[model samples]
Target: MARRERPARVPPRWVVTGAWRVHRAIYRVSGGRVGLWRPKPGRWGTLRLTTTGRRSGQPRSVLLGYYEDGRNLVTMAMNGWGEGEPAWWLNLLANPEAEVEVRGGTRRVRGRAAEGEERERLWARWREIDTQLDELAALRSTRTAVVVLEPL
Candidate 1:
């Protein structure tokens, strides 16, 4: 039997952006007590990432979903499964150095786009986490970047 593919299920752009804003607001209101989590055996985790703004030279923070690959953390530079790259990702591209706050503690790290075999392996891992990863990725015109955050 031939296999069939399902269309990607993504929310409206405004709804997606609004959700991110609300999550950040909750994190701020709770004084960092909530909104962050650690990756589990079969699930991804949320982390608060702080990067230096490329043009402003100031700190900028965003929440990202990641999984552990040895001591390194891996995430995708997807903008709510939207068209353009996210601002946080652009900032990281300008200055690879950044900080991340996880459930147990914080870490200073350097970010880079995964490539070649590294990207394939990491992206496969993400596919395990999100079965629709490829479908969602197809929504964007440009290729989504698999980001690796290595400890500094």
Candidate 2:
């Protein structure tokens, strides 16, 4: 009997990295004006997050979709729905201090991983906006990390 050939799977890491590269390029080439707007209707706004590289100790910026929760800004560390955590989240784990730009206003914030009930509450808000939250998360092996940035 002939063996069936399995379809090739593109590594999620490469996909996520490539996406960030393109996104950063766009943000940069646009002179900080474009790519600063919120996402589509029913979705959250976007923010520019700058985190210190854990190993290199350099600044790294990435645009992330975010929602305002009271005095905190909440974002997911899914790395574009990849199987691994985003680098920014890792940086936050190493050092929770970071800077974020929302609506052209920059602020220092302390990042924290929401746990237990807090996480569920924030995740539920995301689900309200993104109906595919669970479906997208199912693609990854680890549970998604919900990060809350508290202004300092």
Candidate 3:
């Protein structure tokens, strides 16, 4: 019998490009109708947040994974921190005011950073949902943050 080769667990950089292209395409085609589907019992919701670009201060689109922790939406600046605080988080650091669209409505919110015990707890849950995060941690450092969406 011949031996079979296994592929790398993570997609190549170019494949990430393609996946993002598809994501954008679906966002447009469905007017976000076929996109941003939130699975039950976890923080898999796609938060459509508009923030000023950290450098440009121009409006930017950020679609990040979110978990509901009581009254707040919990997420870290990293996907287990592949690239360190994503641009979106940087933007919030520069300007805390931003707009967020979730499920069916849009609202304005104030961004908050999380650390110590609180951050540790939320991140623990994150790791639980996606075990792949542990492997990625070896490649880079990850920062955690919690954004509070004030009801309008």
Candidate 4:
């Protein structure tokens, strides 16, 4: 009898390090078209956020989700099963002044920490996506702020 060859797998799972790098690649590949949205958090859309370079003061675009609070955008650096935050989020930490690009449009946003009522409201929404985020939120909740996009 002849030996049979085994079939190969269709597609391989991605093997990469760094949360933001994985995040950026996913955004680019999908073109920010598809995302799984659950009601608890309202919406989890494509990563099309643009932030300013910490040093150059230029624009930096990446994919991310925005939780809503009336007209404001709520976001976080939630890396599932990971402990550290991403570089982009760190960049925002370095310089809260940043921008975001979404659906072919752009917005200039100023990052500031949410306080009291604002934090509670956004935290309620944040809990929806990942429960693990609660730990992160607790650490960042006070310092966590909304990116208030202004007319540019």
- lDDT on C-alpha atoms for all candidate structures: 0.94, 0.86, 0.69, 0.56
Candidate 2: misplaced stretches above 4 Å?
A: 1-19, 39-41
- Residue-by-residue lDDT tens digits, candidate 4, 22-88: 7676656786553323224344554366676778777776666665555455666643323466556
Error of 3 at 21 (Å): 2.5
Q: For candidate 4, report its TM-score.
A: 0.58
Arrange candidates by lDDT, descending: 1, 2, 3, 4
Residue pairs in clash, model 3: 43-67
Q: Where does model 1 exceed 4 Å of error?
A: 1-6
Model 1 per-residue lDDT tens digits across residues 1-152: 99997778899989998998999999899999999888887689999999999999999999999999999999999999888889999999999999999888999999999999999999999999888999899989999999999999
Candidate 4 worst ten-residue window by lDDT: 7-16
Q: Which ranges in model 4 have alpha carbons more than 4 Å from their true place?
A: 1-23, 26-43, 56-58, 79-81, 135-152
What's every prediction's RMSD, in angstroms? 2.3, 6.2, 4.3, 10.2
- Candidate 4 RMSD to the real structure: 10.2
lDDT of 3 by residue, 62-89 (tens): 6767767776766667642445567888
